[model samples]
Structures are given as C-alpha cells and as structure tokens.
Target chain A: GAGVSQSPSNKVTEKGKDVELRCDPISGHTALYWYRQSLGQGLEFLIYFQGNSAPDKSGLPSDRFSAERTGGSVSTLTIQRTQQEDSAVYLCASSLGRANYEQYFGPGTRLTVT
Target chain B: AQTVTQSQPEMSVQEAETVTLSCTYDTSESDYYLFWYKQPPSRQMILVIRQEAYKQQNATENRFSVNFQKAAKSFSLKISDSQLGDAAMYFCASKGPSGTYKYIFGTGTRLKVLA
Candidate 1:
C-alpha cells in the first residue's frame, strides 16, 4: 500500500523564496518524520529520519531548516528563506522504528509563505 | 519537556451520541506513549487510539476508547457511534520512550458531528 506521500499538494512561495517539500516513505519505513502545522504552532517536530543514521536534527527550526533522506525512502524538507512565519502545514510522517511505531501520514504541504 | 493538553477547543456530538475528548500530559518519563490523532479535513494524521504507558488496560479501537489516567496525566477520548464522518481535528499525543521519538501535540479538539 502506498501510504505516505507528500509533495506540492499546495504551495505558494514568495517571501524570500526557497521551498522544497517532499516525502514518500512507506516501502520499508524505517521511520521518517517532519511536522509543522502553524496557527501558532500546533504540531511541531521538524526532522527525524532513522536508518541512514544522523537525522534527528532536534526538531529543526533554524539553520533555515533542512532535511534529506535520499535512497532510503525519499524525503526533502528544505525551507530556506521563506517566511510569513513560514505559513504552515508541511507534515510528513512514516514510522516502523525510531521509538514509536504508529505514524503514517502525508497529505500535507499547504505552505503559503506569501 | 513533554507536554500535551487539549482543553477542548470545540466539540459537539450527536450523530449517534457519545463524545468525550480531553487529554492532559506533562510527562517526566515512565516509559511512555499515548496518542489519539485524527485530523480529517484532509489534513491526514489518523491513528485513532494508542496507549502503552506500561498498559494498565484502556485502549480500545472498535469505536475508539481511551481513558488511560496514568497517575493523572489523563488521556481521554471515547467516541462511540458518533459519526458524521466523525468531524475532524482531534490530536492528543505524547511520546517519550526517548531516542529521537518526539511528539507532544494537543491544542486540537474541533469535533463536530451533529446530525
């Protein structure tokens, strides 16, 4: 079953532009996550990938936020300069490891940042 | 610093009646895990029931159930029969077995299934 998948379901960049959101975990799911749901931040937790060692970026929220997961499933968060409080809704989850094992979401990427 | 608390932002029930969504959390770690996510409106974050803070017995899923009160860190969600597609937004999460498993959401509660 193709469960998690996220892409440009909706994106509208502008302010300082720099956006790239994509995730596709659900083939072997070794845990992958990235969340951000603003409206004053309701769902936070911005980076975590397990299986390629070195991810848990500590809820990335700075360094302009970055992510990568190539060859291990496909993930790419990257939000360099976009602001407007970064708009919101860029969720992507996948799990089967990494501590908890019940995450499977993707239908997000509503970033606006205008 | 785990913290999740949904003080009911909005709620209504009647599609078949039975609703209760309240969650509280502030973990200090005790081997934890508790969730109840369901964000429809196409937001997609569904996983409607889970609790394993050592499991005291209170996680159901047929009609959804949870009332795990692990020493007052209460986790409630009992929606039975209520369905208007069950309305949406109902997060309440908390994860803490540590090891890069972060999650602590709960400022959601919009559930309106009145029919």
Candidate 2:
C-alpha cells in the first residue's frame, strides 16, 4: 500500500455497459495520471490531475470518457457505454510536482469489454 | 508533440551476458528527461535508469545503465550480467521537464534471459 493502489484489478463487462476504475495515489503526491495500454500498443495518456486545479482532460479519447480527483487523492475514471475497443489495462501513476521526478505506478486495472 | 520509439519488439540474452535495448525519440524541446522503465510479470513499473538532457554524463544504476545520445536523440539501456529475474518488458519514455510533464512511452521491448 505504499505505492499507488488501484481498485477492481480486473473487470469483465458487456458492451454498452458503463465501468468505473479507481485510483489511490501515494500519500503527499500531488500529481496523478491515467493511461491506457492496449495489446501491442504503447501507453496512451488519458487524463491528468494536479492538486485539483482543473484536471487536464486533453487526453480523454472521447466525450464519453471522463475522470475526477477529489481531495487531491483518490480518483476515478468513468467510461460510459463502453465499447470493445475500450478494453485495455488502465494504469494510474503519481509523481511529485517537481519536473524530472519519477512517477510511481499502480498495478493497473485490466478491463475487458465483451 | 513528443514521441518515443523502441525498434526491437523482443530481445534475448544468456544469463550473465550483456544485452542492450534500443530506443529513439523525436522532440524539438531543448530540455527534457529520458527514462527506462521495467515491467516484470508482477506488473510493477520500476524505474531502471534515467538521464537528463542538460547533463552530458550517462546514468548507471547497479546492473542497469543508459547510453544517452542527445544529438542523435537515442537512449539505449544496457543490462549487464542479465539474470532470469530481469526478463520483462522494458519501456523507454520521455517528457519535458516543464509544461504538461506527460510522459510519452514507446511500445516496449520484451526481454528474455536464457538460463
């Protein structure tokens, strides 16, 4: 539990169903990031939250994808009407605000949409 | 936009032997950072080594070291005395120290240690 913790290590859901993934960042870390890693593909940035000063949602793939961080700690990524293509390993990472600081990552949530 | 590229999809090395994983990136920024991360079966993203653009000296961490060529925009990870425990997927990433600080990762190279 010293590292970033993610909930629902694995999730299997049907298409058109909604799913929510959670992330608990390391204590005192102010920056949290979301990324998706599809099979054979590099990790894709999703969203970024830094001390709750308006999250950088620029990486959200579509309007249906959104995320929020409360208390500058725990965060959730929601996917509405999920599609098969949305299946991937959702990774959460946290880092100190200082640039060049290493980012600590969670085990990630494996999502499968059928 | 910044991009990282790992040309090798897979690589193998005999136990105790040395191996190198190649990585390249495209970035116009003059200042930034490059990193190599290892993901074992446990799925933890561990930082193997890092190099700063401003520093001309390379970085070494135990059995892991990096060969950073700033002008060529290449950062390669060299593993010495490879161990079976070293078998994992290694990712090369880059991020500008300023601005968004969003890391751009490569596809990764799957490393295997033959015992």
lDDT of 1 at A16: 91
Model 2 chain B weakest 10-residue run by lDDT: B94-103
**Fraction of native A-B contacts kept, per candidate:** 0.73, 0.56
DockQ scores for all the models shown?
0.30, 0.67
lDDT of 1 by residue, A6-109 (tens): 99899998999899989898998888889899863478888888887888788787899899999889989998988898888889998888555688989888
Error of 2 at B20 (Å): 0.3
lDDT of 1 by residue, B1-115 (tens): 8889888788899998898999899978889888899888989888888888998999898999998989898999999889799899889998888464778898798899978
Maximum-TM-score candidate? 2
In Å, residue A25's CA in model 1 sits off its true spot by 32
- TM per candidate comes to 0.34, 0.97
For model 2, residues B1-115, the per-residue Cα lDDT tens digits are 8999999999999999999999999998898999999998777788888888999999999999899998899999999999999999999999886655689999999999999
Show where candidate 1 strays beyond 4 Å. A1-15, A18-34, A37-44, A47-57, A66-79, A83-110, B1-14, B17-30, B38-52, B59-64, B67-78, B83-85, B89-94, B98-101, B104-115
lDDT of each: 0.87, 0.92
In model 2, pairs of residues that clash are none
